[model samples]
Target: MKRLYFYTFFTIFLNFYANGQALPITEVFNYVIGTNLGGQGGWVNQNTGDEVLVQTGNLSYSGLLLSTGNSVSFAGGGIDPQLPFNAQSGNTVYASFIFRVTDLSTLTDPNGGYFAGFGQTATVFGGTVWLRTAGTQFNIGINKATSLTENTWLPTNFDTGTDIFVVIAYDLAIGEARIWINPAPGDLEAVSPPTPDGTANLNTTRSSLNRFFLRQDSATETPSIVFDELRIGTDWATVTPKDPTFSLEDKFKDRFVVFPNPATNGFVNITSGSQAPKDIHVYDVLGKLLIKQTISGSRLNIQNLKAGVYILKVAQDGRSETKKLVIR
Candidate 1:
């Protein structure tokens, strides 16, 4: 919340859509792991690896940093969570997270280790979306065993003690992937401009994603970085971060009540507390606006929406509130 206060309302408005909607992603799982948005535990479980979870305010979005410490060679892993693994395939899968690095200067490994990203291992081969130090430049690379091919951004992006947000989406069916970087906080679709969107063609068979890892591959390098707010899901919006205060109870203390929550009939009924909502916006997990309806009474007919999770945003008198809705 400290860094967030520095933003002006104008910048915040620019980050979201005109309707004040953001992060359309469905969010299969968001693991802040006891530090930030604590919940049902995730990578903090130490499913694998020896990385330590330390609490720090230095460039941390959630006051937690996953450190790889110093290594002698290439192989020291930081945070390696193998369980509760996402098996999504067929369409696309996305992974988004925030990372901060102390330095990217000593990293010289070409293709051995990874800092953070997703990976899939099948019976024979595997693929990954990870960050590495290419000389003095930081690169986001992808590798797939099927095509025996690899792709990465050219050496241009550099970082030193900065919090960087990365979002990557992989189409399992077509074996294609695209990456967006440091979108306006809540924006999952914003790509790095000037430079073309980071694109890659993984010459491999599409399979269920088996693992997501954060590692410091080069043992010779002692650079330590921290990762926070890691998420994985099916679409762009599913993995994107959304309304920072949406998850805080105090923020929504006596807001409105969204009923028929697990809407079995695809219809949602909303009742505001004391402050009436001027407009109600419904968006898919990917942050795509499904429908915008004027508040006639206090209900919305969602018969057109498919079965899944949706984000509901209510704007009243220039103030806005968000809630997560489920359609069964």
Candidate 2:
């Protein structure tokens, strides 16, 4: 509500066809905890498009990272509800999230600790993205944040997490990627060169990933960023076209809806779009389909059904408009 804008870059639009629609990340993209138990106790929670802002908790490379003070954040964590966490790489990777810097005075890395982009290994240059504390420019290193040899520091003014927000896209298919800072909302420090019909691929190697890495500066200990509505493998979408003022409410995710939540008996309400032909299906926690129905409008009545925790699937009248819902 500070000052909002919208933009689509050309590098991303280059491969705009087929991508006319972005897949609902919360439905497919998953996260297996990197704990000693090998994700036995780790969790992977699906995202709800209602918010353009999803906060993940702390993250790490191998084995569940118990260190929280200076790591990643998850969208809805238990203690640190909105901290960094999920860090993984799969076939189709498109992780997009919005972040705002809260403080830089007390950083983990005094000289700057790989803000936005950080590769698994320092050898992979141009494989990371980062920003300097209270500084301008998108530090796009061809190889790494510290190694400028393969890095390209695209100068800009947006640096603070709250003052600025970025949407990152990693398409493993064509091996391309992009990170747009305050691209859509004007009057902020957004990285330049907007692309409405382009597609980009990242040179960051080292796959078998785990979570989205945006750690703090190595100089200090606490995080200097605050983010929300972190989406993966999809565009800055407008999932729900209804509620007229919907777009203005939440810009991160505009499609998919979970209704009648906080239920009492065993039914819930779900929908995909305002006026699109949709197919509503119910599935169990084990990925088993319980119900599938065709309907129109952004709201569907999911009345009589057994409840314990079912995954509600919805498909809009478009190509990619499916999402999962938890029945209470």
Candidate 3:
């Protein structure tokens, strides 16, 4: 069934692009099974035994179920090719995700389990945020330019079941990283993680970051953690979990217009009448950001995009608007 769906979608996608037709606009990947494009984008399942399960959960969203034996890695494929954080780009990166343990007691690795985080090949430039059985908590372990250190455990009690949202922002320019955790899905943009839930200084300098890892560490770990809504981007709001109540279209209605909706030349013009938008972002139906540009005029060049549906977001003054677009 999965193969059938993939081929079917692939056929449609290829046909549109091959013939210069625009693709459709839809929400990007949010780890929703069946809807998730990770399998095709580069996510690898490295589980030694059982595979990650797609199941309904406490938060009313689809989630990935994992056992002590399950592991996955985003070090290679799953990320969009247009993303800027790839080691080749040298951009600061931010990652956030929501997760919970079905049974916290199952995480009994005294040595700690590398559940999620980013890392580079250079010994001096990797970091892993993991869970250790000793304290039943999550901690950030960073490898800087010369030294590697682990921060204090997060100020949260772990028992059996609870939902936690984690946001990590790493600035390569300063060689520092920070973490934010929320008990529930709150305004991540407005509500900062409580004082005790974050790290102050991660005294490590990095030159390049290669890939993000998920549960790919010591095998001594035996935890069953479930995760949902994993996001990685260059900014805070881009990686934060979003509420389903609001559609992307609602946020960007009538703000800007993209002409030649089915762009014949793979190029479109963006006009906002008088108020010029400060920023413009182009994303695929899967929610993968293809391009981000600071614009002062009314022209957008999408010559590189395959014919498909896209979402164009424009930011002006303090307001933002989203609109559906097509390309041929």
Candidates in order have lDDT scores of 0.51, 0.37, 0.50
Per-residue lDDT of candidate 2, residues 132-210 (tens digit): 4343322222222244333333323333343333445544444544554333322112233344212334234446323
After TM-score superposition, what is the CA distance of residue 113 in candidate 1 from its true location, in Å? 3.2
Write the residue-wise lDDT of candidate 3 on 1-328 in tens digits.
9999999999976653333211111112334453322343444343343444444443322121121221122221122211113452355666766566554454455555556666554222344565655354333332222232354444233333555556665667666666655422233333343322344354545666655555433334535666655567666556554555644453344246678888878678877535544567788987677897877787888999998788776655322446688887
Best model number under TM-score: 1
Least well predicted 10-residue stretch by lDDT in candidate 2? 59-68
Question: What's the best-to-worst order under TM-score?
Answer: 1, 3, 2
TM-score of each: 0.48, 0.37, 0.48
Candidate 1 clash figure, as a count = 14
Model 3 score (lDDT): 0.50
Model with the higher lDDT, candidate 1 or 3: 1
In TM-score terms, candidate 1 sits at 0.48
Superposed Cα deviation of residue 80, candidate 1 (Å): 3.1
- Residue-level lDDT of model 1, residues 10-88, one tens digit each, is 6764443222212232222333322321113333233334444434332223211232221111135443433235355
* Model 2 spans with C-alpha error above 4 angstroms: 1-92, 106-111, 116-127, 134-148, 159-161, 185-210, 220-223, 234-328
Task: Indicate whether candidate 1 or candidate 3 has the larger TM-score.
Answer: 1
